[model samples]
Target: MLDIVKQWAWYDWVMLFIRLISCFSITATTIQMEDYLTLPLWVVVFWEIIVFSVPWICLMLSYRYYLIAEMLLFGGLSLYLTSMFPEAYLTLLTPAFLIAANSAEKSYRWSAPITIVFLPLLIVLFSREIDVFEIFPQIGLAYVLGFAFHLLIVNHRQNEIIRKQNSVLEQYLTQIERVTLLEERDRLSKDLHDTMGHSYVSIIMGLETLRPDVASQEGTEKLDSLLQLARKGMKEVRGYLHQMGSPQDTLPLVHSLRQLGEEFQTHAKVNVRFRAIGEEYPVGKQVKMTLFRCLQESLTNAVRHGQATDIVVSLYFEPQQTRLEVQDNGHGMENWKDGFGITTMKERAAHLQGRVSVYSERGEGTIITCFVPRLVESADEIIRLFIVDDHSFIRESLRTILEGQRDLRVVGMAEDGAQAVELCEELEPDLVLMDLEMPNMDGIAATKRIKEKWPGIRVLVLSTFQDTEKAKEIMRSGADGYLLKSIESRELAETIRLVHRGGTMIAQDLLHKMLDAQSANEQEELLDAPNISEKDENSYGLTKREREILQMLSQGMRYKTIASKLYLSDGTVRNYASALYDKLGVRNRDEALQKGKKEGLL
Candidate 1:
């Protein structure tokens, strides 16, 4: 009963109040006529209480059959009392209104019949003492009013439901928009890092090398100026990347931390020591950022706030969690409180289900420790790489650079395409970093043969050529990614990992050229097949999947590459291609492409 009352609307409370008042008035009026009653007045009052309380309780409990019984009892009592005392008919008006209202609220079909049956009884009872014409309209008005009230309540409840649903949908849309913005920001950051950041670093390195070779002082000074400008640009890029929350995908966690410590030692002129207590392991991007930020904050505070001369940073890797501690030998704070940096550090740690704590004393140094659950990558998650280039120098250089990374293992090296194919058969590396324009068999042919035999092995093209035609050919030959030889070493390693993980990487400029060529070809096909009507186009009845397969085939993509791009199995791609061939009435892929072009379906 309490739970039901808690759920009641204001109108329900009002109805309960009115029903109780009417029950009390009826009881009081019956008590005043005690002289005419056969039974004792107290018994009559008790019986009246039971009659009203039972029906109201049934209504609260939603007992619809008992409500019907209550209606019958009320009608019999009103008729019997009216025969005994005619004035009692007047007091029954409130109970009649309640019955009509509740019945209509439950169901209008039942309410209509119930109201009709009660109307004649009301008229017959009232006619004995008063004119039927005078009271008939009032009785009808009560039923009408009750039905109208039911309609109002239902309308209000529906509106409330719609309002609540709209609120939830708006909140959902806002969350989606926020997520999309973050994704776009991350993508922009990566693009800037891969393109502008790499270019700037290469420029700085080139300038540094040229500085020693310059014979004239003027030339040396010019190179120095250029190097400074390049360094400044790189710094700005790094700051922008930090603002965008870019992940350090290229370097391992330990290397990144060591690099950070080295930078602070060089720039701040403060002694910063870093040590790894346990066996080093890979951690997730969030954990890396949290630890990096905590170290950065601790170093800055030690120099600027604590006036520290030396800082020691320790990283502990455990089975369950990872811990980072930063201690500074400087005058500590007598009273410590969280500022913006410490608060942000705590929030970042908390986001990873971790924590950050600071311990400080007046004379002793301060120690800031962060504890984060270890989200370690598998130890065996290494990319077994094969290098294929005609030049021995290129092959050995790539091997040295890639082998320096913890996750990359150079398993084999091949001089030319022919040797690469033979060695691949025996060695079966996870990825092949193939160089285009090789002697005898080129990279494109070798890639095709390898994909035909081992469709799972990824092939990434590393070449000097940015020719659109060659890129298209290599893609069609089933190469998973393409990169320029001028790409930064770190970017190259990251791209290799990305490709090995079923992602495609292409140089931005080359990708733009390929897209432009594709658009031109599409326009030319449309112009040539101007007479192809919409009905004829629909006649092919190609499904969305079939159309996708056909378009990729037109671009010379092999079955395995198409399957990888679409996240489907090679056998499923073959089935779709076969269906497309039959629908086009073609014997092979070349015919399908030609027919598709003529029909303007590419």
Candidate 2:
């Protein structure tokens, strides 16, 4: 009813073989009547070879289904006809058995119509038999039964083979999905590590600028402790994602350009007080990317080859354009021959329609200036915001950023978390900018208070420390969000709104920390243990860039250091430390230094 005849399975082939053997065996049993079947013997021998031989030839020639049909046709015909001439040709039973064997298979469809037309011939053959119905009727029945047995074998084998193939295919597909998932996760890790690493360094540096505000002797000790803690965090961060490091965002344009004469003064250096002409605005993404790279190349050259400690970084930002000049009192490049670092720097400059000029001589300092336009657009009006930092400079700086936005208006500002807490009571603005380590009251204490008092108001954490768990704990205290101040200003601004709107924010390294999804102790013992934090990065004899890298890695820095230190974005500084790690024969910084001392690298 459902046309199952066309849906025949491979089991039919087994039926064909069984039928052939059975019919052939039937004729062998009639050997005693050989003389009685003498006439039929010649016909049986001649056609037996023709029927079996032709089908085999067709099979060998690749007519697989055609051969199946032929086998069915000849088997059926010989069985019917030879039964009438039983004594005449007993051997004909063998061919009849062959045809019946495969008759159930779909391949025998062609034989179906032919067998119908041959029914008349079948009647004629049966008519010659005396009492044919009574004698040997079970002979044909046995042939059919053997074919059924063959069909069962075929069905079983074919089903087993198909089931095995399906299993293999499913496994292959699952493997592909796992690979894709891993690749996506890696990509996200690189992004968070790169963008947030530089941001953390800058935040730490900015926090260092607030050391003067710490009033008490106990506070000073805490400040020093905090400073060490912060630097250690930075060092550890460099270890993991050292390759994906973004160009040092630590030097906010103004810091890199001027007022740094005394910071590195212990090292003996000249100063360049290059200041902006008017109100200096932050550069664009493309320009920021270029300036970062150019400065990196200059810094690398200064630290590595510039013997003269008198180095000056001058940056002048005007409304229309921004100019960066890095001057040093050291031997400069003698020839135009460039290495990969310098070439890379040049390529980045070209991307922004900018140019870089270098003037250098032996025993003389070098001056590298990269000039690019400071294209300004009116700030977007995204959301209203407020900031509370113990450091006046930080509060003022963040306030300026929020105030600059046409849409965002700072309702109020506070110097300490205490004042912020009080302000939250009165102002009750949309969001609260809670600095983690604040004077009088810390962000954690203030957040606990605010959440208890005004749970609706969101607290966005701004901190330099790598103790992200501290942030997590603060979030547990009802703080709505957390962010390291070193993050891109735009990202910071965006994260605030997202958090205020009920979204959680995390530092880039948080993902790396969570990558294993195991406890800290378990992570250390994991198979193929992924390098996590940088240990003893400060004690390591790494130069500034390398030290910066170690700090990032130790703090769970991902492979975005290339983007941080070198200013390459997207796929920039990935895999930079893999070979370095191998050469050091150490898995991480602590081991690298221990080994380095053995090799006199210390």
Off by over 4 Å in 1: 1-4, 30-70, 73-83, 90-92, 99-106, 116-131, 208-221, 245-376, 380-383, 386-423, 432-447, 456-602
- For model 2, how many clashes? 56
Q: Against the true structure, what is each candidate's TM-score?
A: 0.51, 0.32
Residue 175 in model 1: lDDT: 37
lDDT of 2 by residue, 98-178 (tens): 444445447456543333334324543665653445324434554455456556666786675565445433433443364
lDDT of 1 by residue, 1-602 (tens): 89668668877877678778877887888877889886788877877777677788888766475457566655555665666676566555665567666763446566555654565466465547755665556656776776677667778777765654454345434534654565567657767776787688668766777866899989988888888888999999989987885335446778877877776676666689999888887765546767877877777777666767689999898897889999998789976766667856765665455667788897698999988765432367988999999876678879999998888899999888999999998988999999998899999999988887888899999977578899888877888788887565666876676567655667755765776787688657656765556754556656566787888987889987888787444544665676567557677999988888887787
Q: What TM-score would candidate 1 get against the native?
A: 0.51
Clash pairs of candidate 1?
none
Highest TM-score model number: 1
